[model samples]
Target chain A: MTKELFIQGNQACSMGAIEAGCRFFAGYPITPSTEIAEDLAISLPKVGGSFIQMEDELSAIGAIIGASWSGLKSMTATSGPGFSLMQENIGFAHMSETPIVIVNVQRGSPSTGQPTMTGQGDMMQARWGSHGDYEPIAISPSSVQEFFDFTVKGFNLSEKYRVPVILLADEIVGHMRERVLIPDKTEIFKRVAPYENSSDFLPFKADENGTSPMPAFGDGYKVHITGLTHGELGYPSSSPDDHSNLVRRLTNKTLKNRKDIVSVDLKYCDDADIVLISYGSPVRSIIETVKLAREEGIKIGYLKINTIWPFPEEEIAKLNCDDIFVVELNLGQIVYEVERVVKSNANVHLIGEIGGRLPKPTDILDKIKDLV
Target chain B: MKKEIRIGGFGGQGVILSGVIIGKAAALFDRKNSIQSQSYGPEARGGASKSEVIISDEEINYPKIQNPDVLVAISHEALLKYHTDLKRNGILIVDPDLAHMSEISEFIEKNEIKVYQAKVTKIATEEIGLRIVANIVMIGVITKITNIISVDSAKKAIIDTVPKGTEEKNIKAFDAGYNLDFN
Candidate 1:
């Protein structure tokens, strides 16, 4: 039986990570996301898991990467400013094919705009913040329930692909308390451990799914890792050809299997004329607006983006709507991506605001009314 | 029909918690779909705070309430800040001890919108000796008047969500508010 209880989004995210078999957490205290670290600090120790408060966000991600390589499922969390600092190491995780989860409880920022307020400004940052061409899995949860569910999915995707996965949650969703029905422990998915016979371990060798079987230290695999381009044997390579092949494999693994990674919740979109695209905390607003518009006799629908990065372009491009309105906290971040996928097939309008505020239902409804 | 509600009050008054509890009751107990969102400026106490909830039978598209169908103001500041956004036919529920009823009454009379005034603080403090449960009292009144969810379901939700030892006092506060004559 599933038990429903009121919980903060940050706490749910922490529990989700724990339930998903994450045994290690490394984080720095920051507003909105601090509850996650606090919860994990207390909860992880009880479950025989390890929790560390690193000196900084960069060090936090670095520690998580180290822990992941040691054969333990690991994750770290931070907000905008701290997320900015973790970018370089995030790129390293992608290159080294490290399976680690990074939770970014997004606050308002170009640079420290607001610490305790909410914003979706990090949507683009979650994709390109690391300054590279790699495709990372970024899951955005609109409700406290999805916050928990997607954190588990984030772990699964990270471990399955050997890449860093980000849980892109905003301050509103992170801090707000709501009832979330927690699934039973037996229903949770645990990661697959490395095979036996430690002497014959090949660290970077891909399985049928393109995921490398990771063997940790003390397991006697004698694995060697570096930030530079590495061969299948985990040795650094200087040749451009090797670098190109390695980067391509790392990036292609996630992009090619996007169909398996992407998840979305569609409401009344099958026969709709207008599509309202939104994610994270803003989806709640979009849901209400669409219902009200329907009462007013408008043929409107909604697409709630749960899997934000690897951009779900294929699924969005298939919508044969006359107009699509992308609602978000930033001024046209996800809207640009929506436009890229939709092209000239449908009219796309950007409904957004900044400075830790959300786009209201009336604004979205008014845009839908204008377009229709 | 879709209803957007905004409950505003000082911190520690349980205004945000009330919004969430109501949303949960509506969504889980009543089998309706709901969403709750809250905002508070810096300070933990005596700060301007408001929580918005949207409940509907169908899928909810927008979460933030621009023009709330129902507004519950527990402080004078919240009444002044959010009254303008109340829908034309919306119900404005206020605590007379914290806010001057005349202003809200005048707006109601001028706009012909419904107004319900409850001496929530006095009832909670004097009768129940649990002044902090005023938000729960207000929730009872709002639930009864709106008929959005049954009283039994609301009580069950209160029982299920409130902390262990606090349930009895909350139930008493809710009953007192529910039985209060608004006519």
Candidate 2:
């Protein structure tokens, strides 16, 4: 039987990770995201998984990568400053195509602006923060329940794509308490293992979808990894062709399957004159604002992106609405992405906040009223 | 229907815990939807802190309490800070000894809000023998006055939320507040 536990968002994320067969956790305690580490620290051991508190965020991601290679699903959780520390490693994980979950319970940023306050400033950071052209799979959940469900999805996506999946949650959603019904058992997604013989196994060989099946460290396969561009055999290669081929394949894997990787919860958008594009905590206020706007006889629709990156440009491109408002907790991060997609077609407005506050329903409604 | 609730007190008074218990009672036990959020920062250390909850039969979208229907204030600062935001005909639950008695009396006469009084801190300290259980006591009192959550369900939630070995005393503290003659 499924038991309903009234837990905070961070707890739900931890539970989801465990249920998704995360056997190892390595994290440095960071505010707003510390509860995830705390919960996993206690729960992982009881579930026969190993938990380690790394010295810093660099080691946190590094340990998870090492653990992933060793055949155990692993993850780490952090906030802005910690996330900044993990970016170089985030790129490394992407380059290695390691299946690991990184939960960034986002707090005020730039440099620990406000430890306990909320911010969506990390949206762009989640994608390009690692300093490369690699496409990252990141999801920003709107509610506590999705915090649980999405972490499961995050792990599955990581394993499926052979990529590092980031669950981009903000402090408000991470700290809020709500009812979460977790089932006793859930279907788990494990990485595909090698189908080739040990003698013929190639670590970096791409499948049709560009994902190379990962074998466990001791699973009768010799694997070598390097930060430099490598070919199918996993040896370092500095040749332009090898480097181009490696990076292109890495980016293509995500871009080719972008539709499957991107999902949005669309509400009343078919006939909406104005559609609001939102995610995470701001979606709550947007929902309420739509209800109020309806009472005023205004038609408002919304497209909430639970999957933040591999940005759902296609969804915005398909919308026929006159105006699309990109609402986020950060100033003009997602709006730019929306603008790039809806250029010369729809007016893309930014209803954004930096930190210390979230977008209120009335605030959005007032913006709609001005447009109407 | 949706009911907005604010449980306010000093940082150490377990104000946030009380809100979580109430939210869990309604969401987990009553099978309704409840959302709980809190105030953080420096005020949480010594001045004033609060936890806000919204319980609804339908799914909750906007989690903030714009004008709370039920207000539970356990500190002097909380009472003054939140009364202006309390809706008329709303239920205001306060610890009379903790707040300015004269201001509360004047506000009661000037406004048409229903007011319930209990020495929540005193009862928890005196009857329950633990000052921390005062928030649980406040939970009991609020549940009784508003009937937003059943005593049994709220008690179960309290037991589930508090640390082990302290459940019994917390339940007793709840009873102390529930049993108070606030009429």
Candidate 3:
């Protein structure tokens, strides 16, 4: 039975992570996302899990990576500034192919603009923030229910793909309270463990599924792992051939399995002339505009992107509509991705703003009205 | 169809809590779908605060209320800021002592929107003997006027959510607001 309860988005996130088999949490307290750490601090220890309030954001993610290497599902969360501080470690996670979940409850930024306000300005940062050409999995939640469910999916995708997964929550969804149905324990997915035999273990060796099994440290496997380019045996290799193979494997693992990582929601998109694309807190407003537009006999549809990365290109391509408007809190981040997916087949418009405010439904409805 | 309701007031006035109670009653107790969201500026204690609760029989697509069908203004400042957004036939409820209703009387008259005044503070202080419970009274009065949810359901929701030892006084406040004559 699904138990229903009222909870804040941050608390739901913590509960979701705990239920997803995440036993380790390391983070610093920051506005809009601090309740996550506080809840984890109390809940983790009670369940025989471990929670550490790290000295800084960088160390927080560092500890999480270390904990993941120790064979535990680990996660860390922060706002814009802390997210920035953790970027190097994020790149480290990407390069090392460590399975970890990072929850970024975004606030208005470019630098501490509005600590308590909500924005989707970090859409691009989530994709390209860590200074690399690696593929990242970022999911945005529009409500408290998604806040709970997506955290579980985030961990699942992280384990399945052996890459970092980001739960891109914002201030609005983080602080808001709503009813969420908690799933049963049996419904949760656990990560696939490494082989039991120590003699045959190759930490970075690819299986038929393109994912390498991770052996926990202190398991007597005598594994050697490094951020530096490594061979199949997990040892640093100076040969150019080894470097090429390691990089290609790390990148292709996510790309080859894009179908498993990407997720989205389409509402009344079929038989509609115009498509409104949005994510996170702004999607709530866009949903309102679509309903109001439909009431006025406007044939409009919506595509709410649940997963931001591994960008759902095939779904957007399938829409095959003439008019598309990508709405977000930033000026033109996700809009570019939509443009790439649609190419020149559709006219892609951008409805956006900056600094602590969300685009209103009337603003979006007015645009859709003009198109129709 | 979706019905959007925005309730705005100071932080401790129970404006946000009132919205939550109504939303819970509709979504859980009454078995109707509802979504509640609140926004407050940096000041946690005393800045302008507002909460919106959207209730519908269908799945709620939008959680934010752009234009509210029923606007409950618990403060004079809220009355000044949000009065213009009420729909043509929307209802505006306010405390007569706190808000100068005559200032927007022309707009209300022109738009045919009903404006009801209640002495929420007076009733909470005199009848319920608690000033802090005025917002609960306002919520009961608003529920009565809008008929969005049954009074019995609202009373049950309030009783279930409020802390122990305060249920009796809150029930009195609710009944006082429910039975008060609206002009």
Candidate 4:
């Protein structure tokens, strides 16, 4: 039987990771995100998995990437500063096509701005922070339940695409506790093992799905992995053709599958002219604001971005709205994305905040009132 | 119906845990919708800490508390800081031993707040033989006074939350507060 429990968002993320067959967790304790590592430390060993507290964020991501190669669904959780430190390795994980889950319970940024506060400043960072041209997959959760469900989704996406998936959560969602109904069993996504014989296996070759099957360390396959641009055999090659092909394939795998990879929750958008788009914690306030605006006879719709990366351009572009309000915790990170997609079509407005305060519903309603 | 609650006290007083218990009771056992959030200083103890919860029969869109329907202030600083934010006729639970009621008598009277003076710390230390269970005692007072959560649900939540081997004493502390004659 399924059991409903009151659990924190971070704790749910940990449980979701465990339920998704995550057998290894490597993390360094940081506020807002520490609970994830703490919960996993106690739960992992009991489930026959392993948990290791590395010295710093760099080593934490490194350890998980190494563990993922050993055939375990590995993950790590961190905040802004730690997330910044993990960028180089995050790029490596992308280049190497390593399947791992990185949960960034985002706090204030640019440096370690606020340790215990929430920030959505890492939206662009999640997409472009790793310092490469490769497309990344990021999913943000607006509620504790979504935090649990999305963590599992993140692993599924990672394994399916053979990429590093970021579960982009903020401190407000990370620290808040709510009811989460956990089922007795979860559907796990298993990575495909190479089908070729040992003598004919090409480590970097892609199947029809645009992702190569991965074999564990002791799978008796000819596997040579490198961060440098590699060919089908997985050996480093300096040839321009090899580098372009590798990068294009890496970027195209996510771009071509954007429809399947991206999801949004649209409410009352079919008949409304003003759509409010938001993700993470800000979505809660937007939902409340939409309700209040509708009660006042104003037709305000809500478009919540569940998948933060690959940008959800199609959904934003299809909205025939007069105005679109992009709400986030930072100073206009995702607002620009809205502008880029809805260029000259609708007025894009930004309701951004900093210093740990959530964007209030009253304020959001007031903005909608001004527009109406 | 939606009820917003805020529990405030110094750190190490289990202010956060008390809120967690109330929320857990409502959400897990009573089958209501609840959201619990907390804010505290960097210090592990002594600084003013607060935990806010919103329990609703319907979906809770905004996870933050606007104006508290019930404010549980267990310390002097907590009472002084949050007394004005209570809604009219809202239930206010305070520990008389830690927070002096005389300081906020004017505001409490003006707001028509129903104040319950629970000596939860005294009962936990002297009667229950454990000061750490004072929060559980306060949870008992909250359950009985507000009627937001059932006695059985609150007790089940306490058992589900508190550490092992101490559930019995914690329940005893809860009974002490629940049995207090406020009439």
Candidate with maximal lDDT: 4
Candidate 1 lDDT, B41-74, residue by residue in tens: 7677989889988888876544567789999999
- Candidate 2 CAPRI grade: medium
lDDT of 3 by residue, B1-183 (tens): 678888878778888888888888887777888878787777777777888888888887656677799998878888989989898899899888777887888889998888888989888998888998998898789888988878878998889788999999998888888887876
Clashes of each: 13, 0, 0, 0
Q: Tell how far residue A152 is off in model 3, in angstroms.
A: 1.2
Per-residue C-alpha lDDT of model 4 across residues B1-183, encoded as one tens digit per residue? 999999999999999999999999999889999999998876789988999999999999898887899999999999999989899999999998999999788888898999899999999999988899899989989888999899999999999999999889988989998998889
Q: Comparing candidate 1 with candidate 2, which one achieves the higher lDDT?
A: 2
Better of 1 and 4 by TM-score: 4
Where does candidate 4 clash, by residue pair?
none
Interface RMSD of 3: 2.0
| RMSD after CA superposition, every candidate | 3.3, 1.7, 3.0, 1.2
In candidate 1 the C-alpha lDDT for residue A167 amounts to 95
Tens digits of lDDT, candidate 2, B1-183: 889999888888898889999999998889899999987664436757889999999988877788999988888899988988888888888888888656767676677888888888888888878988888889889988999999989999999988999889989998888887865
lDDT of 1 by residue, A12-79 (tens): 99989888989999999988799999999999999999999999998999999999888899999999
TM-score of each: 0.87, 0.96, 0.89, 0.98
Model 2 agreement with the true structure over A1-372: per-residue lDDT tens digits = 998889899999999999999999999998889989999999999999999999999999999999999999999999999988999988888888898999999888789788888888888889999877798999998788899999999998899888999999998999999888898888788689999899999999899999989998889899987777898899998889998999999999889998778999888888888898899998998888878888887777889998888999888899998888888887789899888899889888888877568777988888877865
Best by DockQ: 4
| lDDT: worst 10-residue window of model 4 chain A | A363-372
lDDT of 4 by residue, A264-335 (tens): 999999889799999999999999999988988888899999998888999999999899999899999999
- The superposed Cα distance between candidate 3 and the true structure at residue A195, in angstroms, equals 2.3
Stretches of candidate 3 off by over 4 Å are A196-200, A267-272, A285-300, A355-362, A369-372, B96-113, B116-132, B163-176, B179-183
Error of 1 at A129 (Å): 1.2
